[model samples]
Target: MENAENLLHKGVIEGEEGALNQFYYGYEANDPPEKQLSPPLKSKITGISLKRGQRVRLETPGGGGFGKSSERPLEKLNYDLEQGYVTETKDD
Candidate 1:
């Protein structure tokens, strides 16, 4: 579905080495699913199969803001940019 977390085992399959059969990555923020009325839905995945000799790269989805993005402090937002947590256009 839309906005779903990405795959954890997204990497190149290289020489003879076994990859992880299971995926354990971070998740997006628990924002309300619709209309900002109900609580966030639970996010989970059953399992995944990996091939041998696969190079694995693990990454977690960054969570969204709890409230309006504008409500976030400029200092913190700038910090995020400085630390490469996120990027924004000059206009933003």
Candidate 2:
């Protein structure tokens, strides 16, 4: 992944700013996969045997959000909430 940037607010990955790539690898049924930094862009594996249920997760870079959440229109916000894209938050 590359070219992921958000000016004001982040897109999905937390605490990440600008264009970056994130990679994760773990076996199935694991609660969470470990983050891999500086992973090779391409790799070739030979003679490696693997059991079933192995998985790898890759997050590609993408365009960042354009505006603030508070400034979003009510209708759009409501639609996002209803569609499970955004969750409702309570002010403390």
Candidate 3:
């Protein structure tokens, strides 16, 4: 991904004041065969659509958060392409 800007630090504040796009390699869950679903759906019946080089965003809640200004990688992400709801992952 290009143009990634880190927007926060560890319990302080740093960088630009806005959202940051984080990129990762993973597969999106695909829909089932012959099953009708939303065109932008990320998950199918029992599998996820295989993909790579996807991006997600992270931001502070209520327009404020604890962190310093620095470049910190995303801890974990399972973000939805459509809803923008990020789920934390247990992987590093």
Candidate 4:
């Protein structure tokens, strides 16, 4: 994906503050093997060696919100509340 600037706001806290890179996309296959799973940073990858009551699944995709977190930038929402990422509800 190579959008190393924490593109698409990877776990944003001011986009992880001056972030250099924090990509997330992963793989490995077969609960029944029809062979398909590859995205992000995959150029020539082919490695699947699992057996022994095999069962594997690791799918993750949800990190792209650029607005409406109260429309950010109160100094990045006080640095996401002093780096606890975010908290203070009770309709904060």
**Most accurate candidate by lDDT:** 2
lDDT of 2 by residue, 1-92 (tens): 22332223355433323334554554465544343222443333234333577666565554555556677799998998999755587444
How does candidate 2 score on lDDT?
A: 0.51
Per-residue lDDT tens digits for candidate 4, residues 1-92, read: 54443344344534322223322222233333444333343323356555555444543334544445666778988888899666666241
Q: Which runs in model 1 stand beyond 4 Å of their true positions?
A: 1-56, 89-92
The lDDT for every candidate, in the order shown, is 0.42, 0.51, 0.34, 0.46
- lDDT comparing candidate 4 with the true structure: 0.46
Prediction 1 global C-alpha lDDT? 0.42
- After best superposition, candidate 3 residue 87: deviation in angstroms? 14
TM-score of each: 0.33, 0.43, 0.19, 0.26
Rank by lDDT, highest first.
Answer: 2, 4, 1, 3
lDDT of 3 at 78: 25
lDDT of 3 by residue, 1-92 (tens): 22323432223355333334332223234533333222332222234353464322233322333454224444322223235543334233
lDDT of 3 at 63: 35
> Which candidate should be chosen as best, given TM-score against the real structure?
2
Error of 1 at 37 (Å): 38
Off-target runs (Cα >4 Å) in candidate 2 are 1-19, 33-50, 81-92
Tell me the RMSD of model 2 versus the true structure. Answer: 7.3
- Candidate scoring better on TM-score of 1 and 2: 2
For model 1, which pairs clash?
17-53, 29-63
